[model samples]
Target: MTHATAPSPDAPLEASATIDGAEWWRSAVIYQIYPRSFADANGDGMGDLAGITSRLDALKQLGIDAIWLSPFFASPQKDAGYDVSDYCAVDPLFGTLEDFDTMADAAHARGIRVIVDLVPNNSSDQHEWFQEALAAAPGSPERARYIFRDGRGEHGEEAPNNWDSVFGGPAWTRTANADGSPDQWYLHLFDSSQPDFDWSNADVRRMFRDVLRFWLDRGVDGFRVDVAHGLVKADGLPDFTPPVGAGSMGGQAADEEPVTAPYWGQEGVHEIYREWNQVLAEYDGQRVLCAEAWVDPLEKMALWVRSDEMQQAFNFPYLETPWNGPALRTIIDKSLAAFSSVGAPSTWVLSNHDVVRHASRLALTAENPQGHGIGPETGDRPDRELGLRRARAASALMLALPGGAYIYQGEELGLPEAIDLPDEARQDPTWFRTSGERYGRDGCRVPIPWEADAPAYGFSETGASWLPQPEDWGPYARASQRGDADSTLELYSRALWLRSTHQLGLGAIEWHDAGDDSILWFSNGPITVVANTGVTDAVVPTPLRDATRILASSPHDEGALPADTTAWFLTP
Candidate 1:
């Protein structure tokens, strides 16, 4: 934890040479924890705060600077805690507020910062404000906090607009009156149980500001703003159609310009972040705010990370880029330029709770589209060996880049998506909302395997897991990989250790002329990183041929790197 002080924003990027800084997030590796799937402590088939507290040491040992926990806020268990009922309270299923304090204290004691998920775009319909709005008449103050409008039909039978939910249905859900008659229709861009907030309303903005203070007072380091770009609706909330094949949950083609949907990435959201930035500035330790803004075109995404706004934004363009070398190079260049333009650091993420794990993603063909989950009925199964190889290589390449990065839970163990879970065991709303058209994200959210031979893979004391785990995951268990030098877990540990010790994340990139389009070779200070994405083994770039290889994603020939392999070397 001992390192130099942070440099000023205008100072040279190379001067920020260590993880220790008021701006610690700039080059830190943050691990994402999907609570219910991380570990279950209560024997109730659910992961709780105490479970997370008990696991902090493992994360500390993994070399992550912080941990980003998905929503554990009070909710009706709809949308897996994303549909929040109370912003300031912890859900009983997870733990009490005291439990949260204990977890936060535990993490802080381990020198790990905590970033909680903040779902501001919407709230559970059961939330007090939403319920009050439901009981109050239309146009009342309670209703004003949310988007409530009269329907197009005479009896308010029709929805307010033709918008479809991101979860795959109409965005507007109509309500019934006390007399069982049709009432006002409310907007919910996600599930019917979660109603969108009206940022245009002063009270709504004030409430969120207070919520931010609540956590800040409780010593939480930051928030991962959920749907960060969707807080404000387009003026007039006009009817609009999303461009065909448009995706907002990341994994879109890096070159495509995402059409600004009426409900997403409006200019007003900037004002919201600006206000939030002021609130964060009031605290010490450079408390950060990372936006989950899936907005398109790296330029647009950069706006969310301006000096007066958020500190970091997820580099979805980089994550979405294919495994092709030229494409990755283009994205890395574009992302660095974009974030630098705003004086903000970019965040590289390979997988998360909302998408398929990168291991499976890298192995799949174009037939398995991004954002869609796979199941037993899938026609084209991912090539497990190829997927993991590419995934490990991707991790090495990402770690060598000059910015912050995120490692989703179990990713260090090289876990692939459990694509064959029973239909009845599924819990993601996207599954039922799409009526089996899409398998949903449940495949990637399976419980982690802590011990190879324990019941439920050591997820819970009662051998119960919220989601069913694949029986064949023993080889991928963390315990099985802990001592193996070749295991993905150890690979990540060594890479992270090397990354921190070498300050690779703080170094400016200098691309090497590889002469081959499929080879990516770059120097970050004293470290050289090379990846071979070609179909055949490739000779190491001549410029770095004499450099000693320090770490490699796979076993390879003496002078050549295998396809889908990445290696790090000391710059000589």
Candidate 2:
């Protein structure tokens, strides 16, 4: 490993030696592990906390600074762990709280902090709070846990708002009283099985604080707050006006109503975040609190990361933008400018369990020309080389960013999307409700590919994985990548090692317009990253006058890269 020394001029001249509570996230690289897909310990073909504990060596070898485990809370799995039935206990399927304790202890011993996902906006219908709220009398303390209203008066015949659930259908679900009359309606912004909590209620807020305390008391490091912006909604029930050109974009329609604004990033939500921050601070800076805010406008995104709020908010633009040279450069420049304006630390991600995998999204071949396509035939096609090149290029750019970087599970192995699920086997409710237009996230949620020849690729030694393993995953398995020096796994390791050894974490980012539409050039002090997104080679302009030391390349070539390739250069 290369050793990097702090520059004399770059040294911080402060007198105090105490570490900042929020400093843990700055320049940290987080590896996201979807518990159910990472490893299976009980031979149930499903990953558990114990399974994750067994894999700490792999994470350490990858040079990741932290691990962000998706929700392992007790749930009905309605939204794949997003709907929490019990915030204080680990689900039986994942493992007991003891398993979590062991995992946390082991991770910390290796200098890796563990940040678990916390969903505050919604809870499973089976949760004690939600169950009691469903059976409580009007205006009772139990009823205050959620947004519940009586059938009489203004609440009758109309919903509190015109908002729709993210999964599809009405946001409010009406419940009948014992007298056979409509007693009340409850709000759920995601699924009927997951009801939204009322943040306006002081008691409701306290409950979540206790939940955070529960985890912190157990030695957990921090949390990644889920849907941080969706905690509060507009106070008044209002009608939603669809934006001009509804459904024009092949995605969800944008809501143009005023209620939609406050419903996402309301001013009231910050108070809740501040309260949580205060509680976390008492843990002596050992814990953290990051947010999963979906808003892209820099101003809106920065709201969750202001000094008094969350330590960091996930950068959605980097995750959703098209993998092109010019487009990616603009995103990086805009994000840097936005975060700098707020004087807050930022977080970046290219793939997560909820979205399509980056390799399948950015990779392209003659057989899968559109690049969004996936399946068994995708691996062996010679044209797929371009896809692998693009995947590596994107990784190089992500690691070179100034803030925290997140790598989703299977991304290091360059796993493609699982697109061959039969209709009978479809599991994701989001795609099922959308009538298959969305293709369900099942493609990205499939089992992780482990050994190349093991039955079920070693993801399971039993029947089959919860989601069927893609037949094409053999070539991209862990064993295959382990043997190939030019594999995507090696590329990710090289990029990660470079970031660790070069103190690239503390450097300032300077993006330069490379003049060509296919190329993007960015500099972190003496290091420069150039990515080629077009179908042809383009000259990359370097600001430095010396020959660039080729530190890492996606194609493993120090020479000029082909289209869809990315290269990192260090000053010798």
What TM-score does model 2 achieve against the real structure?
A: 0.88
Among all windows of ten consecutive residues in candidate 1, which has the lowest summed lDDT?
A: 1-10
lDDT of 1 at 388: 97
- Report the C-alpha lDDT of model 2 over 1-572, residue by residue, as the tens digit: 23232122222222212234537678788999999988888888778999899888778777788899999999999888888999998999999999999999999988889999999998999998888886778888998888886433454977656766666567788877778777788988778898889999888888899999998888777899888888887767455643543221012222332223445767788999999989998886546788887664666788787777777888876776677777777777788778877777667788888766777676533322111334433453333455556677788878887888899989998887676777666677765666654455677888887788887787776746788787888988877876365677767776777776665765678777777877877788667887778888655454433446454444333345567777677764
Best by TM-score: 1
TM-score per model over all chains: 0.95, 0.88
Candidate 1's TM-score reads 0.95
Residue 445 Cα positional deviation in candidate 1, in Å, after optimal superposition: 0.6
Location of the lowest summed lDDT over 10 successive residues in candidate 2: 245-254
lDDT of 1 by residue, 181-227 (tens): 88899999889999999999999999999999999999999999999
Clashes of 2: 0
> Model 1: number of clashes?
0
In model 1, which regions exceed 4 Å deviation? 1-22, 248-256, 367-370
